[model samples]
Target: MYENSTELAENKLLLLHIIKSVTIPISNTQLTDIVLENSFVNYFTLQQYITELINTDFLKYVEVNKKKSLQLTQKGENVLMLFKDRISPSKLNQIDEYIHTKIESLKKEFSITADYLPANKDSFIVNLKAIENDTLLLDLKVNVVSKKQAVDLCTKWKHNSADIYNKILNALINE
Candidate 1:
């Protein structure tokens, strides 16, 4: 069994709470209300945390009624399952399959070769190659991205795209 640090555990718990309280396509106003009602976390912190979550792909924006609202991704759902003690080997396998299929589709789309291999019991590595141009390595600890889109990103941003790629790569590594 993996044991998490106190701070990490607490932050995960807080994220779970936020995910649960908000509806699909939740507005900032609704998220603020949830933060105000459920936890002692301040509004600014809650907003900051939500933005971070979105950047990390745990949360995504949904367009509803011409408004952008937040919804949890599969990654967020998995995190919540972890918090609820409902994460099992079978569940993990299902998630893995889903992620793999997504990656395959992306690879086909971007004309890139990708290898999604288990790094450890808890994480996976997605190493991508762009047909001798550049290698874009994404170390995904918890979330998944499309391989083809990743390669396309590399192709589109190959020249003078290091800064943006570096920022994204840094975020993935830090997470």
Candidate 2:
């Protein structure tokens, strides 16, 4: 039983460490995939640990680019630094390696954002952004009279952001 508890503690630390080591905030899905791939913890238990960390103010869940993402708080970083030795050096290296491999794809995942809000009773305002390495390449807002148009714009933005960017740039340069 003592060993099990120790393992749980290590898992929590591991989770925090992984979050800190990454360049961008991670979604729950990304966290789950990495944890399950590297650790012995199951999905439900992993979620429980995440909740406990959030409740304790060690981790904060926030919407980044309109998607739920996990970020390590300063308290979490300090705690990890204090107990990080309990996790082996080799394990740390493995975590770093895994994140390094996935870094580019993860950046791409969060590089675009789309959201809508009610502007008034009759219209909705859609916000769209395209980002690269923390730089905002495009920020657009459109007002439409119907929610369906707002939704469709968001969907199309997600699918064709690159093409849209090129066309806009080409128009500006040619004009």
Candidate 3:
């Protein structure tokens, strides 16, 4: 177990590191194995760390065939991103609320209209329509230059007004 003052921060980092490094869901035994092999941390201490991570909503536990697995939640992902960005708590909370509002507003304003049109001789065009108060309509179109380039682009959209951009990107990729 860690000292009370640093336990939360330490466990949060450990969980984020584990999740970011592993592509597959990790079992407790696997976590212990990695910790023992790579770090000076002990099994019991690591277990305590994992428990704290779960309690703090950073990690989620799943049971498969009587084996337990851990994965990061969206909140956990946000935590990791905040750590990467070195964002202050006040700035992080502000960004979080901003993103939330944008998403909700975009979802309410837009609808997919058409998809998978030939952008060129060998490309695709995705179309979307914005509905204002369920009455007025505005159309937008996005061109995908290649099959490989048609992957979801909305996942990368971020800004104060990124919601509309993400909505259009999502409609394109899904279409």
What TM-score would every model get versus the actual structure? Answer: 0.40, 0.76, 0.42
When sorted by TM-score, best at the front, the candidate numbers are 2, 3, 1
> lDDT by residue for model 3 over 95-120, one digit each (tens)?
34543444443333223223345678
What digit string (tens of lDDT, one per residue) describes model 2 on residues 1-175? 2367777788899999989887697899989988888874789988998999999999999987668899999999999989999887888898999999988767766887788999999999999899987788989899999999999999988888889889978998897
Error of 3 at 93 (Å): 29
How many clashing pairs does model 1 include? 1
The sequence of per-residue lDDT tens digits that candidate 1 reaches over residues 1-175 is 2244554445544555454543334566655654475443577767776888888887788874345667788887777766744333453444345434444332333333334555555545554433312243432222235555444544454433335446776887896
- Better structure of 1 and 2 per TM-score: 2
Q: Least lDDT summed over 10 consecutive residues: which range in candidate 2?
A: 1-10
Q: Candidate 2 has what TM-score?
A: 0.76
TM-score of 3: 0.42
**TM-score top scorer:** 2
Clashes of each: 1, 0, 0
